[model samples]
Target: MDNVRIFELAKKLNITSQKLISLLEEMGISVRSHMSSLDSKVAEEICRKVKPKAQEKATIPRSQEKAQSRTSEVTLAETGRKKPVQVSPGISLKEFADLIKKPPSTLIKILLGYGEMLAINAPLSEEMLALLAEELGLEVEVKTVEESLLEEGEGGTPELLESRPPVVTVMGHVDHGKTTLLDAIRHTDVVKTEAGGITQHIGAYQISYRDRKITFIDTPGHEAFTSMRARGAMVTDIAVIVVAADDGVKPQTVEAINHARAANVPMLVAINKIDLPNANPEKVRKELSELGLVPEEWGGETIFVEISAKNKTNLDDLLEMILLVADMQELKANPHTRGNGVVIESRLDKGRGPVATVLIKKGTLKTGDIIVAGDVHGRARALFNDRGKRVKQATPSQPVAVVGLSAVPSAGEEFLVVDEEKTAHQITAERIARQRARIAGPVRRLTLDDL
Candidate 1:
């Protein structure tokens, strides 16, 4: 008799491959992949374990099944006591089920009863998990930490550790002079690039302030895209909130503040348009205080600076504050290892085919390196710094526009440095195949008879 793979057996049993894999692992089968071949005798044993013989199935009574479920539920309600299972934030339902010593399928059925149809890998908030645990007669404890979906970069030796530039994100309401401030700093007219003076795209730029480099990420307002603004806050080391002195705080300004706070980054308040006659710096300060931003001048923690992009007043002070904050944070990264970072933006160019703006969080990205961003993989044929200068290498905390990806990756996707081109292609192919399999996985379709 020929051998069969685990997935084939799962299909025959009308179950998912993932469930089969988990079962095999629990059984100490030493299986690595669902494609791993099983011995003929072992496959038969597995089939018997998953499903009983036809005679047994016919003999089992429906009343017995209901009684068994009721008994299990009653046992769970009476057995457990005060032990709380510790779980990370946004833990998947399957993982939570395992933590609670229950089968994932049981939890899935419970969720279905609650009208929440979720994937096996879908995450549940702590509150939701607590409710589920309560029903299961279990207790759960949540662990909090600064979270990042990006993969950890390669480690570095002491000699390779160096201070990197600070990645700053500018966010605020519309007409807050965000792009204009960046234009003044970079000494270029990027405000003209946007239609109607509203920045439509995320722009990363680098500038030298008093001999030190700072990379600025100019994020679009929520009117353009809320996701873009959220991405900006997540990736940045510092957030410079540009509140118009004349306008104080607007609706979008509060949105920006919330985004920054959620990212848990240090914030600096920039009182822009201070040169205007109607500009009230004191009124802006009072409004920010109400929002929990007590200025340093007022004996609070936040650092605030008054500036005018048009008149070029106190621009240096803002830059100095950014550098000071970066120094206090003590940002350092490894330059000798492979690069890993988030994709700030991606677009197709008529001339260049596909291009992406990548901000390196750790390690160094060089030309000719194989990179994988999401399911897309390609060689780094070229790299240009934020200033559009063609560069041979990019270090940590630097934003570079890359050319030669197989496809334009989605904004905010984390890219990893792969060892070889063939390996990169293989990994990307596996990822794509997994995505396709998930899409084609078993789903309960709606039927007219059910309706």
Candidate 2:
């Protein structure tokens, strides 16, 4: 058959052109007007959906009946879980359900359970992709990081995109063993009582495990994590929420889960305090599953690791899960380009002047690079790693303390490297001006008498 016009299809289906167009739009099939054309495939799909009565009344050949029944029975459910399904963001629910070989009705029902009144024709967001898959007991892989690599070219080709360490954020309640867990991983005493050690200071540290690296952002809680997101920086790849097995899930724990979900970062749960006699890992799993973070052991995708930070038990297992998730994400960056990153933290030091801890998301940051962060522009006079050791250069996913910003930058500010100091100044100046304009509002004109 030939490509069908919107009006023709609408007439054939006994529906108005506008209604048919709305349906097409819901499917994300960009037909604009009554005269818009639909390809043969789309026309067939429309006919199948709108003319269901005709299809039901139509007779099928005896030879093809068995084949049709077999095709209907064969789906992802029958095939069993093979490999994770790779999905691109912004696909319609119908498209996604078809990709997973599941019925669109199932997806719609799942969405309704989550209070999302979306239809099968609605386009699913990236977060929805992960959520719907989890509920259906399927795995979905969204091509976000690699698509970003291609977009953030930074004057380099795809060849420059290489594997980078995953930036993992740990968030939870105050007394749920977050500090102790971090201390165990880094082998350093985190001052739980002082903000200078963890709360006030937003820092990121990397640990080498089994010849691979994992970077952890030590933020106070979900607040700091979301603050960075609000600044338009997606610095975190995976979020590991620390939950106490003995205490079960607390109010703050729920907040952390919601924050992680809102950020749309993949989550792994660390069931801490398992060393306690009263610890109940199963209870913790049940509570988290109710919050939509079902553990893999329970037939869901979320990884749950029961550990005791005090004894440093099962720490390797948690780190291994993090690496496994990171590997699946396929994190990469173009380290050869100019530095691009976000400010993890910044403060004015009496001796060193304005010091900013920046996590380089892509490219190599050097000591002599002219950089602009938010509204501040300066030369990177020096660079120091998480260990306070002086470093000449930093690569992708490497967090470094930079010296030479004229003013302390806010955490989560976008940090960039430019060709010259003047360009940096120009960019920062423009940003500052724009901020001022927003604050000042539109200029008020004089009244008619004054004019």
Query: How close is every model to the real structure, measured as TM-score?
Result: 0.63, 0.64
lDDT of 2: 0.80
RMSD of 2: 24.9
Per-residue CA lDDT of candidate 1, range 1-451, in tens? 4799665676677655666777888888887544467899887877888863231112223345446557766786688645467676667988787777788888888878888887889999766786788778766777531112122233323444667899898989998999999999988889988999998889888888878899998887633234544445245889999999999999989998887887788999999999899999999999999999998667677888999998889999899778767765767776555688888889999999789999888777899988988688888999998778999988888899999999998887778787777657656675676679889998889999999
Model 2: residues with Cα > 4 Å off, grouped in runs: 1-156, 192-198, 442-451
Backbone clash pairs for candidate 1 read none
Off by over 4 Å in 1: 1-159, 222-233, 433-451
Candidate 1 global TM-score: 0.63
**Residue-level lDDT tens digits of model 2 in 63-86:** 454464456457644777456777
The clash count of every prediction, one per candidate, is 0, 0
> Scored by Cα lDDT, where does model 1 land?
0.78
Give every collision pair in model 2.
none
